[model samples]
Target: MSPRRRRTEEFTSYYGRPVLKEPTWEALDIAGYIFAGGLAGASSILAAGAQHTGRHRLERAAKLTALTAISASVVALVHDLGRPERFVNMLRVAKPTSPMSVGSWILSVYGPLAGASAAANVLGIFPRAGKAAGIGAGITGSAVATYTAVLVSDTAVPAWHDAHDVMPFVFAGSAAASAGGVAAALAPLAEGGPARRMAIAGAAVETAMSLTMERSGKLSAETFHQGRAGTLLRLSKGFTVGGAVGLALGGRSSRLVSTLSGLSVAAGSALLRFGVFEAGRASTRDPKYVVVPQRERLEQQGRGASDRQGAAAGADSMG
Candidate 1:
């Protein structure tokens, strides 16, 4: 008689369904909002630098870009909420613990300040007020660029939550890359040196952080390298790196090269945001991504407790 084979239980959820609900966010609206918000936030900071350095063309371009990007982002956010009042309602209360509530207040304050800065630049009025507003916007814009990472990571989604440690740096780098890219493309060659440097530095940081997140060895990290998410992230890295190289090699001497490189960097930044969003959504569809990690954590804890008990027993025997 053949020995009876033991059946192994597979890791799965009840009825073969996912353990977590998939996020309902529309890809275009949410992804676009993330990209635009980052661009606006980083551009405001670049605008301040340009203003202080007397790079008038770069300053004007960055200020206008910040205003336009922020407005578009607000529109996307409102549309996603299904009604304008839904967005306004968020401002009725300030909840520091709630990313949505805090983001709402940040947007409200940053929007007017960005508008004032752009208006001052274009209309030639309230010079002093505009300077202060620009400074204030820069400070808040830094938060705007990276807070989406916190918002997404704060959720139950495996991919996003697991990436909380490196996600903010990824978003911040992408933001800087996009903002610098746009400024470089719009400003004259002579005024584009700072933008070029910014783009290069940002691209390097983004690529490094993304790699770190993907190579974290966590099961959730696998989601970033599968199917649609993988393709988008690959393209993002390629474009970002290629653009940075182009800027470094020829941006100083050739306006055409600078423009193309800048556009590539901006596109890469957008793709990075979309790729991350898709990865998080994909993770929710698979039960193993969630269940396996949880099981592993429990096993580790059990092992630790057993080791401590063994050590205590040994000490008692010695005594």
Candidate 2:
């Protein structure tokens, strides 16, 4: 009789449930907060640069945009927490190791600076103080734009945690692209050169980093390219690339083209944020994303230990 063949057991969780609990964040609230924060942060930086360059219209538009976006982001955050006091309560203690704590502090500081800058610009008062506030906002705005990536990556979600190395860059690029697009669409063509350049560069970086992340060859990476997340990401890539091309080819010659292209890029950035959020949520529903990586790590450790033991045994025998 032939030897009985051993069956390979498939990985399964207790009661076929997910190994990790999915995040309870609402898609609209959390993803919108992410998009708005990035837009606000990048707009502040662009506004500061435009001011120094004598692009008054662009600077004013960017400042207002930053203020509005940040305000919306705060509202979304508060809504997600289910109570306004919950957000304020986060300020009761400062925990440097906690991303949520740090993010709350960042929002607190950035919000006032952004508001001050926008108010001074619109009212044409406190010119020097407004400039200072704009500068401060620009500095903190960077942290605001990229901190969400850190916050998400710090979680136990396989998709977000595994891509920590590239997530910040992706978020930063998306922020710049969206900010630049909005500024370019709103500002006069004569003053939009810088905005156009920023949009193009940001789109390139966003696309490259996203591709690098998807190609990481980990089981978690598959979450990005399957189901609803995949569809959203694919559409985002198309819009971003198409918008950049349109800006490069016709942005200088026509206002309509520039506006359309800028809007496209902004839309793409928003979609990307939603897609990333969805991917993390989807990863938590699958046990393989959590189990396979842990198993692989243990197997590697086992092989290394065995090799070390054999080497030690050989050395003792020779002695």
Q: Give a tens-digit lDDT track for model 1, residues 115-233.
A: 99999988999999988888888889998898998999999999999999999999999999999998889999999998999999999999999999999988789889998999999
The candidate 1 region of ten consecutive residues with least summed lDDT is 1-10
Please give the lDDT score for candidate 2. 0.93
Q: Which stretches of candidate 1 lie over 4 Å from their true place?
A: 1-10
Which candidate gets the maximum TM-score versus the true structure? Answer: 2
Cα-based lDDT at residue 253, candidate 1: 94
TM-score list, all predictions: 0.95, 0.96
- Candidate 1 yields a Cα-based lDDT of 0.92
| Per-residue lDDT value at 171 in model 1 | 99
Each prediction's whole-model lDDT (CA): 0.92, 0.93
Model 2 ranges with Cα > 4 A deviation: 1-9
In terms of lDDT, the poorest run of 10 residues in model 2 is 1-10
